[model samples]
Target chain A: MIKPWLRIALAGNANVGKSVIFNQLTSLNQIVGNWPGKTVERAEGTLFFKGYTIRIIDLPGIYSLSTFSMDEIVSRDYIAVEKPDIIINVVDASALERNLYFTLQLLELGASIVIDLNQIDFAAKKGIRIDVEKLSEALGVPVVPTVAITGSGINELLSTVITVTSGERKLKPLKVRYGKEIEKRVQAIEKLISTKLPQLCTVYPARWVAIKLLERDTDVAGKLKNYKNGKEILDYAEKLATELEKIHGEPSPVVIASERYGLANKIAKEVTAIEAPPRISLEQKLDAITTHKILGYPILTVAVVSMFALIFVGGNFLSAGLEFLFENLSMFIEWGLSTFLPRIVVDLINNGILAGVVAGITIALPYIVPFYIILALLEDSGYLPRAAFLMDNLMHKIGLHGKAFIPLMLGYGCSVPAALAAG
Target chain B: MQSGSRGSSKRRNPRGIKGVISLISLREGEKGVMAYAVGGFGLVRRLAEMGLTPSVEVKLLRKGPFHGPVQIEVRGVGLALGYDVASKVFVRPLKAKLDD
Candidate 1:
């Protein structure tokens, strides 16, 4: 009998090399498509492990599961609705604290997870140390350290996945405690939602949805509006918020975030060990000059201009080289065609379609490729945010703020993808 | 209630006239009729966060082409605000000080 397929999800923040890890796991066999009705791209691949085919889906990178942004909404919706068997939460080892914020939110979603501590080599080189065993024990999930770029720990990661999927390893869910009033509100709303929205009860934990509703989350509130008891739930949440404000003197959302961060700080201190303060590394020195108030804008302009200048000069040289090669190939093809085909047919193949296609490819590669490479380098080096910060005042004058700069910087690669991202 | 200033008060209304972009063009340090704050992260929000909220004293430093982005000094910070966002921000231009 064929074994049942197990679904796994790889999720993390942007620029954590999740794609690199996905490529390593899937090798040459991967399928890319859009999520239903959304512009976000979805990648699915399969691995044959331990006599069973395990299918892995790479979801979009998101900062938080709070439905503030569209990507966050899509990611949260997928995990809450689809209920994948396991979620591989890939985190950047160097920036564990910020990454752990998302991890805590993921835990709240109630999905089984395996934390993949990626970029261990870089972390070690920078004098950062993490105790994987202790981390796994604390989070109640298997923690695998990986250097996806160099293929380190990949096999062991795969083995861990197999072991966990096959029931060889068991992980208990980690629960976070919100304060007394919030807990009471969560329980009350969960009871009402469970009874009213029976169909969705199995999809997402009612308590999670209830917590979001009490935070005045428009997305969750809108989703629950069709239910018969939606109004009753809203009224109960408002009353609870009023009572809590009287006692606590703050809003529910702020209180919940503070609790989550407090828990994250505790977990971070327990699992990870630091030798000393982060040194003023090369990146910091570069940032000091590039983001400096006096010379910053001039340096940024020079860098951008020089990058474009290099692309233009290199394109001319490459185009000349390719032209010589293509000319010789055309001559060879012409001689062979003359021996077997008519003159008009030969002309059509050589000059009509083939020449035009070759010209298009040549133009696209030398010019477009270098520009894209520079943009990617800037993005990977983490200078784009600094650039946005410097240009914030200028952007505001144009009726947009610095946040819009993120999408504009992305547009350098492809406008279509940038538009989707901006949405 | 000085005798000479009493007649000037009738001619110059304390609540400045609600003129359009013309009022925004006036130099800073001039007294204004009323200043209103635009809420949220709109053009007004960005300017306000930078200490250029409506009703605050403003001086037009430079105006770009054809009612384009205008540079103004507000609370010691120089800012360039777009024409559209600036137009949305309502202000009553204050009268020029006697020393000026």
Candidate 2:
């Protein structure tokens, strides 16, 4: 009963409600796994709608498509190579301009895009009004204003996904105009690529390859160099980039970035208007005490200590319960076998493989489950950054940040199981 | 519109510290708008690509006395950056008005 499936990718910055939207769309139909040999988490889910079986892939949360991190490389490569039928760029309405920067980059790769203008509720509360239709027109993509937490606009987003991918709706993905000098060089490079390495043009947009080449993006360069004449194409791009840098008096990457931001800012201003901002709200008030210069560190200490205590106590409880349950089971087996079986057979079953299995279950699962719960809680509730902000100085003293400390603490907690294994 | 405003403001400042402060210099609870991220070409590009730009607002959530990495909130998201990188990121303290 397997039907042909259309693939959709939900791509967005962290805290922009991408996961919430994914949760709403998939709703317990997700398989949380990891990319092969990568520690980065991957989530895939399936949705059946209107006689079509669509598979949705939630790419890693990333701010940009640059190869500055593994997540970025994984995300961008998937979109480029896999060529998902549609890319739903989940944008934070409250942070429209910054989010749009990523959307624009997606467009450069020539993917069919549907802008999920998420968190409209937060934006409206902050007195930011967006003309959704106007933004859609500006970006040449269907922009759906959504409160993903409540499932608002989810249907519209889905329908748009269907229509756009099915080619029922024809739209032009907006291209960033990086002015004459830069565009000229890009064209020259694109021509070189299309002529010499025409096969690459099929995989990636010729102009994007040219642009990435000029910016010297490592991941793209790595891929390009493996091609038939990628080195010559890269050298040509390097020459053009140097020439542009000479004229601009700044690095080509910087020059390219300024243009992108400049365009994003301009587009944002055109479609947004402010109503009246609300009074100083709950998050700010909480931050005042939890992030205050005097009170922040104390609060940070208590939170971490309490988290450790809770995990230690909870893990110990689970550990003891499992140990007791397994001890009785193991003893019962040994007794049952000893009554009728040979002594050697009974001892081997009791002390060898059974012991190893019993040791693993009792020792590992308890600590691992609780530690993950605390980690996910901190990560999801938006407290890790605050903790990092609070502990930056203290952490820096030990050559780590608050982010690095969390995993290190998890490792230390695992020592509990290691201790049990030793016994 | 943004470029015009920046030009007018720059003309009046001359030598005034119009909006130039390192990311690390920001105190707790103070928010500013990112203006320029200066460093080697690679660093500037990476920072910009990561959403540190002229328009986004950044708030210092926590920091240490000196030579400590700075934690900041930008566009309602948190990020921790080292002292060296933070020092190179120049942000302008938000004025009485909300720019966004």
Top of the candidates by TM-score = 2
Q: Taking the tens digit of each residue's C-alpha lDDT, what string does model 1 give over A141-173? A: 999999999989888888887788779999876
* Per-model lDDT: 0.70, 0.80
lDDT of 1: 0.70
> Can you write out model 2's per-residue Cα lDDT over B1-100, one digit (the tens) per residue?
1212332532233224566666665666678887777677778887776667655788877664345556787644567687678767777776544543
**Residue pairs that clash (backbone atoms under 3 angstroms), model 1:** B16-B33, B28-B58, B28-B59, B31-B94, B31-B95, B32-B94, B35-B55
Error of 1 at B81 (Å): 19
TM-score each candidate: 0.71, 0.80
lDDT of model number 2: 0.80
Best by lDDT: 2
Give a tens-digit lDDT track for model 2, residues A261-325. 77887888889998896778988788567756677778878877887888889978998998899
Q: Please give the C-alpha DockQ score of model 1.
A: 0.03
Candidate 2 falls in which docking quality class?
acceptable
Error of 2 at A340 (Å): 9.1
